[model samples]
Target: MAYKDQKLSEEKVFKDPVHRYVHVRDRVIWDLIAAPEFQRLRRIKQLGTTNLTFHGAEHSRFNHSLGVYEIVRRIISNFENRPHWNNEERLLCLCAALLHDLGHGPFSHSFEKVFKLDHEYFTQQIIIGDTKINNILEKVSPGFSQKVADVIAKTYKDKLVVSLISSQIDADRMDYLQRDAYYTGVSYGHFDMERILRVMRPMEDQVVIKSTGMHAVEDYIMSRYQMYWQVYFHPVTRSAEVILSKILHRAKELYESDDFIFKLKPTHFISFFEGKVKLEEYLKLDESIVHYYFQLWQEEQDDILRDLCERFMNRRLFKYVEFNPNLQMKQWMELYQLFQDAGIHPEYYLVVDSSSDLPYDFYRPGEEEERLPIHLVMPDNSLKELSRHSDIVEAISGKKRTDHKLYFPKDRLDAVEDEQLKHRIIEILYGQGEVKDVR
Candidate 1:
C-alpha cells in the first residue's frame, strides 16, 4: 500500500521548547493543523486550571499536539529500516499523534465534568466525520481517516502502530511530561529522551526498551510520579478547579430558575446545560468564550455566581488545610454550618477536594484493563515486566496515592467584625486554641 502522493513544497517548522522543532513534511498533517477544528486547540489550554497555579503553563493543546507529533517522528526515524517496524505505518502514526487531542475544548476537565462531553468522541468525529481533517486524510486513501482514528482509539489491528502513540510509555506521555515540565518550569520532568529513543527496539507487536536502558526507564517513571504530585495534582490547581465547577453549577442553576434574569443569555452554554451540544458550537467554545462569560458574570445579580467568578478571575483562590476525611467527618459538617452562619454560602464557598491517582501500574492479570505494560528486552531476547526487575517500579506499582484537603475563603473570614462567630469558625477550622495563638 502507498501513502497519499502528498508532500509540502517546503517543510514547515514550529519552534517548540520541549522538542526543539516540529517538522511538517506531509500535506495531510499540515492541512489538519490548518483546519478550523484543529486550530481551536489554540484557544483551549493544555493544563486547564493549572495555569492559575503555574503562571507559565499558559500553553495550549496546539503546543502539545505538535510535541506529540515530533516525538512520533523521532521514534519512527529511529525505527526506520529496523526489523518489525513497517514503513507503511509511518504516516499512520504521525496522523494519530497530531489529531490525538483534536477534540479537547476550553477548560477541558471542568467542561467534561459539568457537561459530560467526551473529547475522544469529538476527536473521532473531527477525523472521520465531515470535516477538513477527514478530507485531507481521505486524500491519502478512502480508509486512511478511519485508520488514523483507530490508532488513536487504540483499536487498530496493528499493535505496532497503536503502541507507538497509545501505550503506557509512548510518544504522547514522552512529549507531555517534558513539554509540561518545560512550560510549568518544574524540574521533575527532566529525563533522557535521547537515551530512551536510542535504546528503543521494535518488537513483534510493540516497542521495548533494551535492558541496558533500565535506569533511563526508571528515571522516566520517577519523573512521571514527581510531575503528577508536584504539578498535575497541586492543591492550588485543584482549588481553581473547585471554583470553576461552582461557577458553572451556579450559572446552570440560575438558568433553570424562573427568577433569574440575564443581561445576555449564554447561548453557547444553553445547549451544554440542556445536554445537547453540537460539534460546531463546541468548537466555537474556547477559553476565550468561557473567560468572556466569567467576566460578564462578575456583575451577575446572583451573589454566588458573581463571587465565584471574581475569585477565579482575581486569583483569590480557596485556602486549603490538610485533613483526614474518614476521621474528620463531624468537624467538616460543623465547619459547613459555621460558614453558613458567617453569611458565606457554604455550598459555593466551602469545599472538600480529594484527588487520587496511581502513578504507574504494572500488568495485573484480570486486575486492571491490563495497561500495555512496559517491557525490558534482555540479552537472551526475553522480556521482563518492569516491576519484576526494578525495585522503584515495584514499590510504586498498584499503589494508589491520595490527598484530601478542606477549602474555604480565609480572606472573607478575616474581615468579620463578629468576634464570637469569627472565633467559632476559626476554632472549627484549626481546633480550639490554635486560632488564638496564630492571631
Candidate 2:
C-alpha cells in the first residue's frame, strides 16, 4: 500500500441513522474528516430549512458527508477485483465525497441567493487554499489537492471517478436521499441501494448499471422524484426559506443604510454586503451565528428588521397561495398594490418562490452544464440510455415541472386597521372568503 492507501490497524466506525455504520479505514480519509474544514460541515444542516417542516430532519451535513464517503468506499471496495477500475483514484473519490459540501454556509440556499455567494467556489478555495484541508492533501503529494478539487468540480481527467461521485446516481445523492428520508420519517426515499451497487460496474469513462438492475434503477429514480416533492420541495419548508431570505435581505439593507444603528454589527456579514467576501469571512458563519444575529435584531429600532427576525426566530412564517405569475399577472399586480396601499412594503412582504427540476435526463450534447446521462449496460455488453429502457424515467425525462407560491404575512394583513382593505385581500386569497390552510 502507498502512503495514501495506508489502512488503519482497526477501522473506525460512526453509528449513523441512515447508513447504519459508516466505516473509515484509510488514514488519509480519517485525516480529512478530522480537519477543521470538514468539521465545519457539522454546523451546516444538510437540508437547510427542511427541519422546520420535518422535526426529525435535524441531521447536519457532517452526517450526510460521512454516509457519502462510506458509500463511495463501499463502491470502490466492490471495484477492487474488477478490471478497468483505477486503484489510484480510490482515495480521490473518498476525499471528494467527504469534502464536496465543505463550502456550504448557514442556510445555504437563501444565504447564497442573498449574498450572491457560490458554495462551489468556496469548496474549491477550501481544498486548494492555504487551509487545513489543503495542508492534509499536500501531505499526500503535490497537485493532489487540485486533483480532489477537480474531481469535485467534475473536471477530473478520469471521467469514471468523476461519475462515481457526481453523476445522477452517484454516492452523494444516494446518501442524501436515504439519509433525509430516514430523518424526515418519509417513505419516499427507500430504494434497493444494495442491488443498485451490485449492478454498478466501472467502465473506461463512466460507471454503468447492468440491464438486469433496471428495476432497482427505476426504484431509485422514483425515490428521488418522491423525495423531491415530498421533502425537498415542501411548501412549508419554502415558507421558512422565504422568511430566512427576507430576514437576510432586511439585515443587508440595514447594514448598508445610515439610518440604522447596530448595537451588534454583523461582523461576519460585512464582507458579504460589500460584495467582496473572502473565504475566511464566509467560513466564520453557521446556523447558530445567524440565529444569534436574528435574536438581537428583534430589539433593533428598525421595525421591518425587528419584525422579520422575530417571525423567523419564533417560527411565524408567512402563509402562501398557489400562484402562477403568467396566468394570474393581473391578480398578482392587484395584490401588490393592495399590499403597498395597506402600508406593507410589497418588496419585502410580497414574494414569489418557485421550485423546479428535471427529475432525470439523457445526455444532452452542446448544452450548458450537460449532465452525463445515466446508461444501462445490457447483457450483450452494449450501453443504452436510462430513459430508453425505463418507462417511468422516460415519462418525466427532460420535463421540468415547477411550482410557484406567493408568500405574505397573513398576521400583518389580518391586523390591518382598515376593514375593507383587509376584506379585499382576504376575498382574493379565498375567492368566497373561505379561509383554508391559513397557517
Query: Given candidate 1, what's the lDDT at residue 42?
Result: 88
Candidate achieving the largest TM-score:
2
Quick one: RMSD of model 2?
A: 2.5
Best by lDDT: 2
Badly placed stretches (over 4 Å) of model 1 are 1-3, 357-369, 398-400, 416-418, 432-439
TM-score of each: 0.93, 0.94
Tens digits of per-residue lDDT for model 1, 284-347: 8889899999999999888889889999999888887776777778777888888888889898
Instruction: For candidate 1, give the lDDT.
Output: 0.84
Model 2 clashing residue pairs (backbone): none
lDDT of 1 at 131: 85
Model 1 CA RMSD to the hidden true structure, in angstroms: 3.1
**Which pairs of residues clash in candidate 1, taking residues 3 or more apart in a chain or in different chains?**
none
Q: RMSD for each model, in Å, please?
A: 3.1, 2.5
